[model samples]
Target: MNGSYNLSSGTHYGSIGTATCVTGYEIHGTANIMCDNNGYWNGSFPDCIPVDCGSAQTIENGNVSSTGATFGHTATYYCMPGFQLVGPNLLTCNASSEWEPYEPNCQGMYPYAIRK
Candidate 1:
C-alpha cells in the first residue's frame, strides 16, 4: 500500500496478513487476508483513508477556514472585527486521528481602551 500500512506475516501461501492503518488514518476494507494456494491474496485489498475530523468546531464570534477535514488538512481560525483569537489560529489533522493542539476559541477584544 502506498500509505503507511503494516502487513502481518509473510506473503507465502497459507500465511495470514493483517492490514492496519497508521495513526490518523482509517481502514476502508478487510483488515485481514489469507494467502491462497495459488500464490494470490484472498479477500479485498485494504485501504487506509485519511481520518476526518470534520469541519472545525464553530467558534464564537469567529469563522474558520478549512481545506476539508481529512488528515493533513489544515484549518485556519479568524475572529470577528471586535474579537481576538484566544489560542492557536491554525490546526492540522495529526496522528491518532485527531487535531493537534486542540481547537482555539475567540475572545472579546481587550477590555480596556488603548492609549497611544
Candidate 2:
C-alpha cells in the first residue's frame, strides 16, 4: 500500500518479474511472477502487507503512545515526572517488520540508567 511494483520485462507469455514491497511495507505472497502461456500471471498478485513491529513493552516511569504496530505507524515514549527517557524516544515500523532506532527505556531522574 505504501508504493507500487514494476515488472522487469513486457507482459508477454514468458516474461518474469520480481514483486517487492516498498520501504516500510512487506510482501505477503509470492515475490516472483511469470507470464504464462495462457496469457495470465502464473500466480496470484502479491499483497503488500503492512510491516508489524508488535506492541511496545512497558517502560518503568514512562508511558508509550502508539497509533498502531503496523507499518508507517509510530510509537513514542515519554517519561513521567521525575524521570527521563533513555535511547531513542521514537520508533517506527519499517519494511523489515522491525522498529526503527530500536526501542527505548526509561530511567529515574536522579539515578543510574535503568533499562526496561
The lDDT for every candidate, in the order shown, is 0.80, 0.81
List, residue by residue over 1-116, the lDDT tens digit for candidate 1: 53543445777898887777766778898888888999987988889888887777778899999887888888899999988898899899776557767888888876987889
Q: Tell me the RMSD of model 2 versus the true structure.
A: 5.5
In angstroms, the error of model 2 at 50 is 1.8
Question: Candidate 2, residue 65: CA error in Å?
Answer: 1.4
How does each model score on TM-score?
0.80, 0.72
Query: How would you encode candidate 2's per-residue C-alpha lDDT over 21-114 as one tens digit per residue?
Result: 7777777877788889999888767888777889866688899999898887889999999887889998887777788878788777787679
> Distance from true position, residue 32, model 2, in Å?
2.9
RMSD of each: 3.8, 5.5
Worst 10 residues of 1 by lDDT: 1-10
List runs of model 2 lying over 4 Å from the truth.
Answer: 1-6, 110-116
